[model samples]
Target: MKFVIYKDKLVESVQNVSKAVSSRTTIPILVGIKVVATDEGVIFTGSDSDISIESSVEKHENDQINVEVIQTGKIVLHARFFSEIVKKLPDKQVEIEVTDNFHTIVRSGKAEFNLIGLDAEEFPRLPEIEEGLSFQISNDLLKTIIRQTVFAVSTAESRPILTGVNWVIEKDLLTCIATDSHRLALRKAPISINPNKSFNVVIPGKSLTELNKLLDDNQEPVEVVFMENQIVFKTKNLLLFSRLLEGNYPDTSRLIPDESKTELTLQTKEFLQAIDRASLLAREGKHNIVKLSTLTNNTVEISSTSPEIGKAVEELQLERVEGEDLKISFSAKYMLDALKSLEEQELTISFTGAMRPFILHSINDQSQIQLILPIRTY
Candidate 1:
């Protein structure tokens, strides 16, 4: 395959698709990126079986030609070397030409390199997801939903299902839930779409994390297509495919409390900063635990103690405190994560009791919620 591509455009597309190429793949060919040049434009594909990414550099977009095709063909080059070489090439443009024997040459301003390429025919084909179930969501909103929940997915592979985020779409609302048994994150967003379709799919947390990195914080819509075992995300010039985990995601609806016995409203940033300071001492402790107690003076006390080191105590003034006063201990790391995901200035934390899981969310935003299981510190 022979083609001339703009260096900046090529670098960006390569960097994007490279996220899916795993260096330790058993299949040697999987270590390379497949480039296909056609009359339309150039397409780059990277995959490691679990996830696949396809990005194209079209001939013209927004009235610009990013690629000029000299000849139409296909080739596969080592992903790591090719990507590094392209990015560092000392030119504004790159010319790639492949021979019939799969020997590829890369040339730029005063620099040339030749590498053995593989036959693109051996690459695995992306699953053609027929119109099964689909939805559209803004890129920024999707990124928000992913960041809010993916952190809670189980890192332990003992129960593989818990390693993925469960997505449930009904009517105009989409709900995303993730849990590691100790804590949970749930986010809901209303999206406009065709009526009468509901979807339940468990996508790996790793996949969602990758997708998050690929998305730009824009208002453009991302089209999602789900088949029996695969989910595809379509953007302007990119297509991302992830295999769905096989198993029923545990029902987490009942775990979230429907009512609270004690509720406290505090500034989100204030609470976050208090936890951040308290965690320094907690980090020295074996369990990294912090104690939170609602005080009678409309303040929440954040404290942590380590037997061998020291202790930290800080008070954060609250906007309001209601119901019964409560004292709870939980992982400071979990609390910080929940706090970082909040896009609000004020937050409300609801505690059912000192023993049960407590909930944290934006004061006026009910669509996003974070729950933390208390740590036993007797």
Candidate 2:
């Protein structure tokens, strides 16, 4: 393909599409990016078997030429090398031309390089997903939901389903849940537009993590299209496709207790800081466990002890403490992760018992819930 394009726009598009490129792919063509120049614009595509990304650079936007097409053609160049070349190009414009036998030349400023390109026909076609179930959500809100839950997905492959975040949409509300058996995160938000049918799907945490990075923190709406096995996320100039994980996500509703034996309300920041300090000592222990115990006069004691290191004890004043007296031990790392996901002035933590899982929720927001199982310290 022969085209002249703005350097910054091309760089951004290349960087985005490169996220789907797999370094260990058995298919040699998958290591390269496919570029197609047409009358409309230039399209760049990158894909492994699991995920694919396509980004377009229009010929002209707002009466300014973004791309000047010299000829309509297609070629594939090594993704890694091409991306590096584009980034280091000395000029604001880049000219790319493919000649006979797929020999490509890239030129910018005083630098020019000849690269052996592959036939674009060898690249796998992107999944053709017919628009079936679709919805729109604000980009910023989607990023928030991912950040709150994706961290809790299991990194191990023992239970493959736990490696993905579960998404369920009913009526006008969307709920996202992630858990690694030790800790769980759940967040719910109201959907601005609802589809005709409910959707229950498991999306790999890795995919969501990558997609989250591509999304900008803006109020613009992102369109989502759902098919049988693939999900598509689309913006103005970008299209992202990810294969859904196959398997029924375990039902986690029953894991949360109906009632609590002990309930405590405290400033979220104070509690987080106390746990942060206590974890310094707990790090020397076997499991990094921290103990929390209710004290008299609406206060709680956070403490950790390590025989090899030292002990840390801090008293945090609570806004309210009720129900039964309690002492619970849990992983300080897990507690810190759960607490950091929340942005609230105050939070309420409820303990079912010393052994059962406890839940943390914002005092003002009931849409999110974090649960952590206690660790036994003997």
Whole-model Cα lDDT per candidate?
0.92, 0.93
lDDT agreement of model 1 with the native: 0.92
Model 2 root mean square deviation, Cα atoms: 1.3
TM-score of 2: 0.97
lDDT per residue as tens, model 1, 215-276: 99999999998777899999999999999999899998888999999999888988899999
Once superposed on the true structure, which residue ranges of model 2 sit more than 4 Å away at CA? 192-195
Report lDDT (Cα) of residue 261, candidate 1. 96
Q: Tell me the tens digit of each residue's lDDT in model 2 across 262-296.
A: 99999999999999999999999889999999999
Candidate 1: residue 15 Cα off by (Å): 0.7
Error of 2 at 348 (Å): 0.7
Consecutive 10-residue window with the lowest summed lDDT within model 2: 190-199
Using alpha carbons, what is the TM-score of model 1? 0.98
